[model samples]
Target: MQQSNTYIIVFTAILTIILGGLLSLANQGLKPMQDKSIEIDTKKQILGAVVDVSEMSNQQILDYYNGTIKSIVVDYNGELIETDEKGSPIVAEEVNIPKNFKQQPEDRQYPVFIYHAEGNDDAVEAYILPMYGTGLWGPIWGYVALETDLNTIKGAVFDHETETPGLGARITEKEVQQRFENKQIYDENGNLESVYMLKGESNPESALDEHHINGMSGATITGKGLSDMLKSYFSYYQGYIEKVKSEKSVASL
Candidate 1:
């Protein structure tokens, strides 16, 4: 009995050590690949937020992103300043093109992608910006675009957490996304209305305007959270948007 017990203990210890060593080796070996995968996925998500997935495949998306996007770092006030340009602080730089812009609070730069499609005339669209927020169960992120007026939503795409599967996750569904198509982000009076995920069902009568939409049933929290996220990010882009609008207005005049 004593010999058997000793043998069992020794076997257990040996197995534990072997498994631990293997796990450590695996992590070390996979770290670089894991990081690369994450980077690629990030690029893919950003692209999805900007472009129609049906329009491009994985490799095509990568190729288009590399070709069309130009990153620049800017300040909270939307001033384009070179962080690493002069001998100034290396902290104020933001990516203007296809770079990560999550450095400082009130001093971060965001990505802006341009997509050119051949339509009747040459149709040029700018993928305005992206923002991240907390959802009911996990993190929620989206990309919103603006028209030349900077008040209209050219397009948008959202993704979320575990949620309630068919309920909360519906924010990323095709039917729900279609609700935001061609919608204006602001009211006729230039109020920051964003987009509303209406409760129950969408009623054209109660919409903020012709562009407002109804929220999904059983997913009120997720819908509301998404609207709030849009509002907050729009605040960040207010300066930039205003500048663009002003420039266009001046051009028109």
Candidate 2:
């Protein structure tokens, strides 16, 4: 009886080891594919902020991104710090927004993507800024595309890690996102009052207001999260916006 028990224990231990080894091997083999899937998804999200990418093929997305988008890394002072040998801005897609979010805004490397519309002689149509923040459940992140004026939103695309379905998750809905279109980030006095997601229905008269949007029902926390996220990111990019405005003013003179 003692020998039989020993054998049973040995068999169970061997089976466990074998299963663990197999699982480890599977994970190692899948890591590259997983990384690639994440990369493609991120590109899709970035492109979606500017154009309709819902029906775009993966190759098409890559082609459009490579051809029309120029990425740059900037400092808090709105100075371009990283550039290629030819004096072109390097692609800043690898700037890692989530990691940078934890650092002081001055210390963070901001990634900005300039989208040039086709047949427009390479004129920048919009600037895309990446944003990250906390939601009720987990991390919420997205991209906001600003018009060339740098003060109005062209479009926005948001995604959450673990928001509750039908509630906080509604922030990802198209209708909710479309509400951001044409929203102004600055006030009449030229103050940088970034757009906010209100707690409930905003005043209809204020619908044309530049700084507020009606909040989602039953998702007050999430709405606040979105508002906070937009404000924080817009502030980070404020330096660049100011620099562009200054340059435009000088050019016009």
lDDT of each: 0.67, 0.88
lDDT string for model 1 (118-233, tens) is 33123556645777676688778776766666776777778775777988898887678767777877787887767766666656674545456878788888887887777777
Question: What is the lDDT for 251 in model 1?
Answer: 75
Where in model 1 is the C-alpha error above 4 Å? 1-17, 84-105, 116-124, 202-205, 208-211, 251-253
Best by lDDT: 2
How far residue 35's Cα lies from its native spot in candidate 2, in Å, is 1.8
- Residues 84-201, model 2: lDDT tens digits: 4588665588777888888999988888888887545259999999999999989999999999889889999999999999999998888899989999999888888999887775
